[model samples]
Target: MHIKYTISVIFIVTLVIIEKENNIISKVSDKLSTQLTPILFGPSLSAPHNASADQHEDRLLENSTWSTQQSSSPASASGGQKHILLLATTRTGSSFVGEFFNQHGSNMFYLFEPLWHVERMLSVESGGTNASVAGPAYRDVLHQLFLCEFSLLESFIEPAPQDHVTASLFRRESSQSLCEDPVCTPFVRKGFERYHCRVRRCGPLNLTLAAQSCKQKEHHAIKSVRVRQLETLRPLAEDPRLDMKFIQLVRDPRAVLASRMVAFSSKYKIWKRWAVGEDLPVDEDEVRKLKGNCDNIRMSAEIGLKQPPWLRGRYMLVRYEDIARFPMHKATEMYSFIGIPFSATVEEWIQHNTQASKEVSGVYSTQKNSSEQVEKWRFNIPFKLVQLVQQVCGPTMTLFGYKFAENKDMLMNKSVSLIEERTFL
Candidate 1:
């Protein structure tokens, strides 16, 4: 009995000692974690190291939830006028997205494709084209536009806009601000719905009145696909007169190609032939052209996503897929990023356009059942072409959270979403 009692005491004492040691070790570990956390997860680090892998993952998910990272620069916080540039490539659903800001309110001045004239005039003058050669002109025009200077724009207008008055202002009806009374002859007609700009001829746009209207507005926004490189716009972004924000909109390259094939059929004749199962000469000039477009888009996105010093707080990367799926939500987040109120006018327009029951016709129509529009390209384009685009644009697709399908069956499977849930800031 004495030996058994002694054994019990030893066992109990051993367990107590072990528990105390464990408690001490746990306390020490927690203290180390607290002390090292700042160093591990400081501003110097883009992300926390492997020690906080779970935390890092959570942060990525949070960022991907359509939120903008706050800018480190003091200029971003400074208040006055706001300039928003909805930067995108052709056939990337930029027109529809631009409507978000366009419909903000009467207080917002929105311009649709002002760069249209620049590209047109320059393309004619050069007898061909070179975006690099025209980069300075593009920057100057954009800078002036932000400051409500319309005289520079008049120079680009064909027939030379007699004293800043011209009927040929390149889709003047597309802009609600330009279409409204005082800037044009008659006011917007009653029961005049959005996307019916074609039906309501607002007459000639007066550049003087338009500039006056722009100055009266609290904020200004412009949508353009012509600016080939984000890096080229550094000067405009850093311009002291304007507080600028750039939202870089991207779409799956496959979808862009499919949309462009139909929209610019003349230009994409080669692609249409490929869509019909013709042998895609991957080495041909057409193929190289497609590859070059993809490279330019990807390079611009990289510059924006990297958040260079000039573009730090000003740059935002958004996927058309995300916006299409959740138009109002994404628009709200976008407005928040730009520090604007998500007005009811914008919300009502989004609901009307995105949830349309009938198919809206027009190559450049912003109205559509956006959810269906997101996947419509899959049926329109062939698997072979999809493979080619993926090959050329694989890095871009991966960077923007697009997933690849292994086969045609997988490509047609709508149940399997190709958009991986990832964020680009």
Candidate 2:
């Protein structure tokens, strides 16, 4: 009996030792598999090899860490949604980028320039940008909008379209959605139907219900030119409830200056529409205009540099140059950062929309001649004006890493390369 007990105990001990060895072997095998995967595979068969492609790849690699990453599978990404704001100025391609999002967002609702109401309602001009009285008031209205509360959209305590949510900023998309059950006359055709079933409007009014019903959406976005200051929205960014992210869209000021100077027609006075004050001169002197645009951009960048730690992944700077050059890549990056799938519909929209509509941009026509458009500012703006703009905007320009053209000839003779953007590091 003693011999039998000893044998049994020995068998149990042998089994325990075997199990321990197997656990170590399995762990080591996993370690080897993980370490070897990147090496044994070489780069996946899909990496690009062209000279320009290599350059672009390097650019993307450089900026990869800036785009905030969150778990992006359908379940986590889509269900949570986000409130995205394009913190941009007019003529910076804000409209173009906004349109891109509105079309492809699928589950997202976009507002063109909701703040136009804040100014008209409070009788403040130019978005009340300074932290003075109107500025704070504007922010309060903005806060309410971001929260998906549309009660504020109702006409002011007294009824008036001028002071209502349907004020100047409503734009075609919002205006059309106001068409009620019977559908209002002077209908808006810019996808007004998104609100039809849910809107149930009357006298083209009753949009409060539709706007408040935004809780079900995967995302809500607003594109505004009124917001030139980045820090102005700190309250929203810090709020865990707002779930907001911002994209700072910047364009070459030279290009921006040239685009504004293009002769305006009654049909496409897009630049004039950027005005804030009702009494602000329609045609400000070119020098003053250049200064204003440059200052706004310069300030935005400087402010971004001073952003607090909480905003690290929340604020992203996107260059029109990069978007123009690699629309697909940039779109994919932008959509991913916003927590949405860059679906095939987005791809198809891009393929068809590469030719920007002639109506908005005029001669520059969104035809998207890509690299060529970068040089247009050089050729379109007189050599003298270009030099002056460079002089007036030099420090601000350098702050954002925009290298000036050595000479007008260099604009064409020299190949232009864009410096990605200012790096906080």
Q: Highest lDDT, which number?
A: 1
TM-score (all chains, Cα) for each model: 0.78, 0.63
Which runs of model 2 end up more than 4 angstroms from their true locations? Answer: 1-79, 120-131, 153-169, 174-205, 263-289, 305-307, 356-372, 412-425
lDDT of 1 by residue, 1-425 (tens): 99999999999999986675555445334533443333333354347345477877666455433123333332444346789999899999899999998888899999999988877866675454465556766776787788787766676677777667676777666788987767756644453223334545664567899999998898999999988888888756655556789998999999999998888889877778867878756557877877888888889988887877777788888999999999998999899888888999999999999876665646778888888888778888889889989988899898898898778998998898888987665
List candidate 1 segments past 4 Å from native.
1-79, 186-201
lDDT by residue for model 2 (42-127), tens: 25423345647676556545333222333222234334667788877666667667756676644666666766654454443222
Task: Give the distance in Å from residue 32's predicted Cα in candidate 2 to where it truly belongs.
Answer: 62
Residue 235 displacement (Å), model 1: 1.0
True-structure RMSD for candidate 1? 22.7
- Candidate 1 has which clashing residue pairs, if any? none
